[model samples]
Target: MGRHRRGARREVTVADLIDALRRYPADMEVRLATQPRMPQEHSIGAIAEADGLVWIGEGRQEGYASDGVAERLGWR
Candidate 1:
């Protein structure tokens, strides 16, 4: 159940909620409203609705690797 807003209850921002949820994979239907130029989603749904893999990487000088990529290309 959701807590009712009271005079003493603390307010939580959507960013805080998203940050908390980022610790786990999102598997539900979620729609977030943001600024016109802002991102609409910060996470991906575990249940894919499309074919092919979506590669998401951290913007770094060197990123992590997955052997699955090589196996998929028959290079393993």
Candidate 2:
């Protein structure tokens, strides 16, 4: 009889999220979640958290335009 083989489970890490997000267009929205007080910017890049994961996405624009603009405007 042949022994059964099992597939390895992949672990998602902060780096993994960043790589995946980079594949998308800048205009696209990437969602993740991370520590509230985490450093928002880095010397080589920036980090964003949404839905419990950290990802690298587009940087802030000159006019502060954002895909989730509606949500931000609601605070006022």
Candidate 3:
């Protein structure tokens, strides 16, 4: 048997996030942080272009349902 090693975590850009959202749609999850920070919300929206918002953390997995699309960036 062999041990598995975690792959290098790449810096996910806005383009990447948008692409993933389009591809997965229902499985995409994200977290956003503004200047003063805001409340926590779970939802994903359509990303047309990259804004000034910084991508603090992001990743994808299974088991998410496509309830509805969000209008702004948020958690999931």
Q: What Cα-based lDDT does every candidate model obtain?
A: 0.40, 0.45, 0.41
> What is the Cα-based lDDT of residue 42 in candidate 2?
17
Worst 10 residues of 1 by lDDT: 56-65
Cα displacement (angstroms), candidate 1, residue 21, comes to: 0.7
- The regions of model 1 sitting more than 4 angstroms off are 1-8, 28-76
Q: Can you write out model 3's per-residue Cα lDDT over 1-76, one digit (the tens) per residue?
A: 0112465456666577567567665755454332223333333344443466653432322233332322233223
Would you list the rank order by TM-score, best first? 2, 3, 1
Q: What is the per-residue lDDT of model 1 for residues 1-76, given as tens digits with 9 covering 90 to 100? A: 1133553545454565668678777775443322233222233324332445333332222222235534433335
TM-scores, each model vs. reference: 0.25, 0.30, 0.28
Worst 10 residues of 3 by lDDT: 67-76
Give per-residue CA lDDT, model 2, range 1-76, as digits (tens). 1112454456667666568668889887443322233312212237678888775554433233333443433322
Candidate 3 vs. true structure, TM-score: 0.28
RMSD of candidate 3 to the truth, in angstroms, is 11.8
Which RMSD does model 2 reach against the true structure?
A: 13.2
lDDT agreement of model 3 with the native: 0.41
